[model samples]
Target: MNICVFCSAADLDARYTTPAREFAELIGKGGHALVWGGSDTGLMKVMADGVETAGGRLVGVSVDFLAHKVRPGVDDMVITKDLAERKAELLARADAIVVMVGGTGTLDEATEILELKKHGLHTKPVVLLNTAGFYDGLKEQFQRMEDEGFLPLPLTELVFFAEDGAGALAYLEEQAGIQG
Candidate 1:
């Protein structure tokens, strides 16, 4: 599968990096490809490196402005004109989506994808890897949305909340009809 992962590009503590690396390793060792923002720093770099080292392919979708930060020697790279196009390209290339702990940029990507899925624009499985309980609040918010009827579909159908990398991948694999 071409798993698109949206994550921070900023340097972070080991709590975040460890699980991200572990998830990336799972992507690679499973003979899957990584579709991501294509930054060569921080958590993004950690994921890309882990995936590449574990024998997975890297497919980076980088915007023109941040092209300088794109990783070197990825299996494939595409420079989009802007963020909108970049997200579209990433989604187009991915069979599944994983949203890791991140800031506004990552959150933007995650919500947009979920919104698209909610509208039936796509049916690809989405997983929010809530590493270190970073997304506990967001998970609650989603539940509230479901409870309040703000979301047409159940929150569970819209996205899966995973406490760790293994659960995230396992869910994605099962959704893809790949036995763990």
Candidate 2:
């Protein structure tokens, strides 16, 4: 599976990086490919490195402005004109999506992916890796939305909330019908 992971490009504490690395390693060791924002620094770097070291393929979708930061010698790299195009490319390349600890950029990516899925634009499974309880609030908000009838589909069908990397990958694997 080509798993697209949306995560921070900023340097993060070990609390966050540890799980991200573990998840990346799982993606790699499972013989899957990583489809992600191509940045060779910080958390993105951590994930790319772990996956690569574990023998997974790296497929990078980078914005033209950040092209310089794209990891060198990835299995595949595509430079888009802007963030929207980048997101589209990332989705187009992936069989599944994972949202890890990140800032607004990551949040934006996650929501947009969810929105697209809600509209039936795509049916790929999405997992929000809720490491360190980072996404507890968002999950609560989503629950409220479901309760209020703001969401057409059940909250569970929209996205899976996972507290650890293992759970996230397992869910994705099962959803994609890949025997792990």
- Which candidate comes out best when scored by lDDT? 1
Per-candidate RMSD vs. true structure?
0.5, 0.6
Report the poorest 10 consecutive residues by lDDT, candidate 2.
171-180
- Please give each candidate's TM-score: 0.99, 0.99
User: Can you tell me which runs of candidate 1 are displaced by over 4 Å?
Assistant: none
Give the Cα error of residue 143 in candidate 2, in Å. 0.3
- lDDT for 49 in candidate 2 is 98
Measured with C-alpha atoms, the lDDT of residue 178 in candidate 2 is: 75
Q: How many backbone clashes are present in model 2?
A: 0
Model 1 quality (TM-score): 0.99
